[model samples]
Target: MVASLLSARGLNKQFHSGNQPVSVLSNLSLSLEQGESLALTGRSGSGKSTLISILCGLEQPDSGRLTVLGEAFDGDAGRQTEARWASLRRQQIGVVFQEANLMPALSLLDNVRLRVRLAGQDEDGCRDWLERLGIGELAARYPDQVSGGQRQRAALAMVFAMKPALILADEPTGSLDRHTAEDVTGQLFDLQARYGCGLILATHDIELATRCNHHLDLGHQPEA
Candidate 1:
């Protein structure tokens, strides 16, 4: 049998509010295969972003096991595993958090080119990716020059240019208008399908969530 592209088992995470502990994710388990997509839906504070952070190794779960692209990490990964996760992020994992983390000094096009170069992908297609996302005209603009939604699209363009094997998108369309959101979302799925990459999308948009192959609702989490 083929191993999953990403897997998490018995994951648990919590935070402390000065003294009281607040449970976030409780014994969550999930598996994702290449070419599959998983949607995470819940109200705010329902652990959507938390889950995304954990999946990409930005934040570690209090206790659990996580495997991505064949690299395994225990919940208490700490700083020792950052290099491994960083390598995967540069070449195999693409993350699009709500905040478009674009460099202040780089033009949109340069951001995409940088990502492609880091991933060892051809930079020639960077502009094409931006065009497909409807942001080609703004390629020369800095992040501050564009609207929030446009910056988000630019971020998406960077991710696509990298052609990562796995994508973690947290409200990728949150900043766009309805029409722009539709256009961006279409491109997101199209590229993901063409590349056969695994996707884990965290969104409050029911319509967007329905597009994924699997759905998990944190509001009604299973008992651990």
Candidate 2:
């Protein structure tokens, strides 16, 4: 059996709006093994983004627990130390977001190779990933210089170059047209399979969710 790469138990999150508390996630539980792909589907404002953030250790839940790649996170100073290992997670974990979120100052190639530079690896190989993703020609271009689909594609290439063990994506194709979205989505799944990384994508796109091996529908659950 493939080893479990990530696990969450009783995952809960809440926020306070003025005098009242708004619950975001309640006892949400999930697990992912190496090379697995899970798609999260839900309506808007259903705590999907909150859950994703918590899973990535970007936000702390009011209560609950999470473990990633065998290490536990408690949201304490010790866990802060552990979370500093987020760099390690970044090195080994790819993240694709709806906006592409590339820096305006860097060229496409420079953006993709930035992680490589940070890890002291050869940046030349970034060219191959760009070529594979069919964004090679755009390498010389800046983020604002490209179309939305192209920018997202460039972002994927950047994360792909990392060869992460797990990938957490939130509506990666949300900004693209249908055809372009499908194109980018196909490339992402292909790379995920090729690299044997766990993929957990949060999206409301049914077509996108259908492409994954497994699906988790957050819309059916009661609001937290």
Candidate 3:
């Protein structure tokens, strides 16, 4: 049987404020299968970002069992675990942050090329991904030279180029205007359908959340 794309059980996290600990996530658990899309809906400070961080292995959960693509991590931050997560991020996982995380020094095309190389994908298709996102003309521009929406699109192009088994997107359209956001949102869905990858995205837009295959509200605040 094919392994599940992602699984988290009894995940917990907290943040320290002065001397007091603020609860963020309490015994949170989620699962995803290939070709599935899950939307995380919650207000600000509701641990949406915190959960995303933990899911991507950027932050360690206080306690939990996490299995991604058959590799398991159980509250242990060993070197081998770190190495495994790093490898997964490089190859099987695609992360799209709220703010486009692009290399300032490289042109958009080159950045996508780098991601494809790191992900062990075909670099020849990198520019094609940019073209599909309506940023082909700006491929030669540096991240700083492009507008915020354009830069975000380039970041998305990098993700699409990698063709990862799982995608984690955080507030993907947070900065764009309604029209642009909708455009980008459509492209995101297109990526999922065409690639048949599992997608987990955090968003405050109820309309967006409803479009996903599953909705998971953190419940720290009113649902979006």
Highest TM-score against the true fold, candidate: 3
- Flag regions of model 2 displaced more than 4 Å: 77-79, 82-85, 222-224
lDDT of 2 by residue, 1-224 (tens): 79888888887777989989877677777899999999999899878788878777777777777788777775554556555657655666677889997889999999988866765567779989889999898889999999999999998988888777888999999889999999999999999999898999999998788888888887675544
Local accuracy by lDDT, each model? 0.90, 0.83, 0.90
Structural similarity to truth (TM-score) of each candidate: 0.94, 0.93, 0.96
Query: Candidate 3: worst 10 consecutive residues by lDDT?
Result: 215-224
**Which residue pairs of candidate 1 clash?**
none
Candidate 1, superposed: residue stretches over 4 Å from native? 1-3, 76-79
lDDT of 3 by residue, 136-190 (tens): 9998999999888898899889998898999999998998899988988899998
TM-score of 3: 0.96
Q: lDDT of candidate 2 vs native?
A: 0.83
lDDT of 1 by residue, 1-224 (tens): 54489999999999998999999999999999989999999999999999999998888898999999999998545566998988998998999987788998999999999888999999999999889888899999999999888888888899978988899999988877889778778888998999888899999998888999999998889989
